[model samples]
Each structure stands twice: as structure tokens, then as C-alpha cells.
Target chain A: MGTFHDDKGELHGITVVVETTGPRTYIGRCFEETEQGIVLLDVDFHDPAEHDKTKDEYLQHAVKFGQWKKLAKFVVPNDEVAKVQRLAELAP
Target chain B: MPYDPEMVRPMREELSSAGVQELTTIEEVDASFAQSGTQLLVINSVCGCAAGGARPGVLLALKHSVQPDRATTVFAGQDLDAVNAARAKMADFPPSSPCLALFKDGEVVHFVPRHMIEGRDAQSIAFDLVEAFDKHCVAAS
Candidate 1:
């Protein structure tokens, strides 16, 4: 998990969670807000073949809408990564 | 389909002519943000907001005496990886194309999301940004 700080060096109350979805790559999500920054909870979903494409697709959507602010990512542990990976596999 | 390089070329030139750097890679993004002063990152797009409002707002804002130390842009659809790379560096904010990010020493200070620019006119947005610049960029000292 990582935090995003503002200009005053104060936390933006945002947390980013990073979960592994591949060998070296991770998927991150925000879960809580803090005075210093946001807290992240990692999700596990580590299927390279599946997650890679999905990641690219999500990024493409963000790019298309000029929604670049939504693309923050972070790195995290393997177990947490696997959880999101499994979840992604089950996702419709 | 890919964007028309020829069409965007002119727009790119206009910004460059105004002294804005074009960040086409993650490294460039890092370098620009890592610098020790206020920076303006423009999420450039071909949408109506970009063409009708954001671009003009940027031009007007640049004319302000109290502006950022540096100004840069990334073409959304055209510069896919570069845009994504830059977004990753931003960390928390949700993605909003045709967006405007004000960074001071690699940290995001002010963000103007797409919704903020969507229906607004150039002058109005420029006024907002210039105000931000005056407060954050100039008054920082």
C-alpha cells in the first residue's frame, strides 16, 4: 500500500491497494482515506494471460475518456496479488 | 482506429510554440515531475472539451505572469503508454482525460478533472487555473 500526499505535505486521504495479478505486475485499488493519504488494499488475480489483457483494456478505456487520474497503480505481495487474480478470473 | 497524426501535429506544434514540452514516455514524465518547481501537466485530447475549452484555457493561462515553472502535455489516445505511465505516477486521483494536473516537486497539488472542463468556456477555466497558479505557483515563495 502507498499514500498520495498533497502540496502542503498533507495526506489526500486516499489509499491505494496493490495486488499481484502476474509474475511481476500488480493491480491496485483504493480502500480508505487518511489525512496524509489514501490506504490501499491489495487484490489477488495472478493469471498473466488473462490479467494482462484486462489491464491494458482498462487502461485504454481510461485513456479514451481522458480519464488519466484513475490510473494510479502500486506494487504489493504475492498472496494479496493472487486473491485479486482469482477474483478477476471469476469476474464476468 | 488510430488518431490522425497529421491532425494532431498542428495542435502539438501550437503548444510547443508556446513553450510546452511534449512528454511521450514514462521517463520524460518522471523527469518533468521530478524537477524542483511547479509544473502543469495537460492530459490533451481531441474531445470537445479539449478543443473548445481546455486548449484555449491553457493558452490564456500561459499568458499570465504568474505561471508554472514548466508546462507539458500528453495526447490521450495517441500516446497510450505515455499517458498511462504518467497516470501511474500521479497515484491516487481517478483518471479524467482532458485533465489538468498541477504538480510541485513531483507532487500533485491541484487537479482539474474532465467534468470541470466539459461545459465550461475557455476564459472561465483559464481564470480558475490562473487563480490556482497565482496562489500555488507564485505564492509558494
Candidate 2:
């Protein structure tokens, strides 16, 4: 069976935060969606254990000021992702 | 994929030799940023184009009398986890390697992104950082 994902979804070409089941959280530009995973460019990968601030606090900051890009590219596997939300959605 | 560590060793050492702590793991990055006071984090990259200016410039900037409490670096491609963690701390700016950020009490006070370093000479880049140091850093006793 092929992986089913929207090619024309609002997530493409926009800044998003992809939270994984594990400790990792990624914020970046959604480049594309492939069967393997969601391709992100200019990514900022965050491991909650490595940070002093809570994930929600960090997201709140991003919603206000925006996030810096770290990795040139990253691919998050579909099964590994717990939730995917637009960075703007988290804004008030 | 990350670059070959062996290949980037010299590039990494250029900054490390200047008394800048090299953070190669997430834990190390977190620990470095967790401290109180001003900190300087350099997102080192293997791009000779920009890094040529960034590396030497950072070294030169440290010579200024006013300096941050600590200086640290993480290689962009060769140290993915470490670089990512470092960038997370600098979430307010657009991500760019060969970048410099000054944090005062864990808040970003100044940032120099790739575009600012790309065509600039080492002396010019150093001037930019030195100016930021003058504005944001304190002279150590």
C-alpha cells in the first residue's frame, strides 16, 4: 500500500512544528511529503531533555518571534510523528 | 547526512584552539547554554566560502576587551544533534550556519546570520562581532 498524504495541503511551504513520539521536536519549512516521511528544510530539531524550557513555552516563543533554522534538511518518519501543527496555529 | 569528522577536524580546531568550547552532543550544548550570564554560540560550518570569514572573525572578535562569559561552537553538518540543540536556544532568528549569536541571560541580544558573513572579509565580520561585544558583553575581571 502507498502512503496517503495530501500534496496540496496547507502544510506545504510553510513553517511548522512536527512533534514526534520520542523526545524530538522539529520546526522548519515543510518542503514536501514523501512515502518515507515529511521533508523539512531549514529545520530546528529540539530534544526536550536537552532544554530547560517546556515544549509549550518554546512553541509560544516561536509563535511570537519565530524560530531559527538549524539543519539544512530533515525527514521525519510518518509513524514517528505524534502531532504536526502550524507554528501560527499555536499563536493567540 | 553529516560530514566526515576527520575532514572537518581542522575547521573545528580553528575555533576550538581559540579557547572556544566545542559542544559535540546535545547534553553539552544544553549545559553550555544553561549557565547564567552572557554566552556566545557560533554555528560553525564547513562552507569555506562563508566559514573563511566566520572562523577567523570569531577568533578576532574575542580579542576585544569586552567579552561574553563563555564562548562555544558546534559544527553544522558534522555535529547535527549538537547544532540542532544550539539552534533551538536561538529560535528567534532564521537558522544559518557560520552564524554568531550573543545571549545575555539566555536571551538573544545580537545575531549575525550567513548572509551577513558570506561576502564580507574576516576583518569586517570581526568588526561586526566586536561591536556587538561592546554593546552586549562585559569585561571580565
Candidate 3:
């Protein structure tokens, strides 16, 4: 995982490159900076066969914008991408 | 708090109409939790699961004979500072919206995490909260 400062000198973006070791991994982006902690902008378990599943998972945990600072991005491995594609095909 | 204000207005209205106070600032959150009594802090969200489960469940549970001394909410996405400030008080718990925290004298005694809210209906969550209220909130005299 790597984060970069923007031209404005703010921590504006992040990138994560991963090697999958198992079925899934958890990823989140913090919404704020605080002594206690930052609230996550999004969280999900990723598996290639289940990419759509990851999307739905983030929707489940999505909070209001008023709750925390929005993070630039969040990424995790999608080990179950095939399963996700299959599910999408089955969806109406 | 979880969604845009336009999106969350109905929810904020529902909770406010039900007597749940909305905390929109850090000062407000601090004042509410600092009070010497049992408090229920709801981390409100816009998720369907939260709408179908947590919010209604909390409303129903509030009808119980025993309930938290103060009932408050912080919008997860919309009220950023307020939510962060509220969670700061919670300490150590990962940030989760559509979550519930039960506090006594400014200390967290019980936490109902997000995973507990998903895949459950409103009634089930209400039953859980009513049970918690009966156990921890009833005796707060």
C-alpha cells in the first residue's frame, strides 16, 4: 500500500498492490485524522470470483459524508472474481 | 449522517420525531456523553441494512419500559466531525456505522458492532437492544 501527497500538499490519494494468499482480504480508507482514530470510508473483503460481493459489502458499511472525512480510495484483492462474475450473470 | 442530508432528512426526522437527539458537532457530542448517566449513542447510516434493521430496531426498543437516559445519534457520512468526535469517546472500537454503543458515566459498557446488524431484521435487533436495556439501563437510578 502507498499514499501520495497532492500538489496542494495534502495526503490526497492511495494505491495498494497485493498478492493474494487466500480467499480474501480486508481493506479500508480512513475518513479523518484524530488521536482516537479515523473512521473508515469503506470496508470490504475481496476475492476475484466475488468482486460484486465486495461492492455490496462496501455499500453495507457505507456511512453518511457528515460522519467522517472521505478517503481517496480503498482496495483489496478479489480472489473470488470468478464467483462474482457468475453471480452478476445470474442477476436480473 | 451516513448519507447526504437530502437523503438522510427522513431518517433524521424519524429519529427526532421519536425523541432521539441529533448530535451534529463535537461540542454537542461531548456534552451529551459527559452527563452522569446511561447514554445510548447510535452511529446512524444510510445502508439498507441499517434502515431495515438498526434504526427501526432502536425506535422499537426505545418503547420498552426501560431505556437509556439519553438517546443520541451521529450521522456516519454526513456529520463527519460529530461522528469522529463521538467515536473518539468510544475509543479502541473500529469505526462502524449503524452501530450502537451503550455507555455509563462516560464509559462504554456494551457495543453492538456492524456485523451484528447485517443479515438481521429490525425486530431481532430490537429484541437484542431491549435485552441490553433491561440489563444495563433499567437500574440507572
Q: What is the DockQ for all candidates, taken in turn?
A: 0.07, 0.09, 0.05
Per-candidate total of colliding backbone pairs: 34, 1, 34
Poorest stretch of ten by lDDT in candidate 2 chain A: A1-10
Q: Can you give the lDDT of residue B107 in candidate 3?
A: 87
Among all candidates shown, the one with the greatest TM-score: 3
Ordered list by DockQ, greatest first: 2, 1, 3
Q: Comparing chain B with the reference, what is the TM-score for each candidate?
A: 0.92, 0.96, 0.93
Give model 3's TM-score versus the native structure: 0.64
Residue lDDT tens for model 2, A42-71: 887777788888888887766555566678
Off by over 4 Å in 3: A1-92, B1-3, B139-141
Docking class of 1: incorrect
Please, what are the lDDT tens digits per residue for candidate 3 over residues A14-88?
A: 111122355554334323323433223344344557666564453333321111223334332243222211111
Per-residue alpha-carbon lDDT of candidate 3 for residues B14-79, written as tens digits (9 for 90 to 100): 777899999999999988987998898888887555677788989999998899899999888889
In Å, residue B122's CA in model 3 sits off its true spot by 0.8
List, residue by residue over B29-87, the lDDT tens digit for candidate 1. 77777679889999887665677778889989999889898999998888888899888
- Chain A TM-scores of each predicted structure, in the order given, are 0.25, 0.85, 0.22
Q: Residue by residue across B37-64, what tens digits does model 2's lDDT show?
A: 9999998887653456888888889999
Computed on C-alpha atoms, the DockQ of candidate 2 is 0.09
Task: Report, in order, each candidate's fnat.
Answer: 0.15, 0.17, 0.00
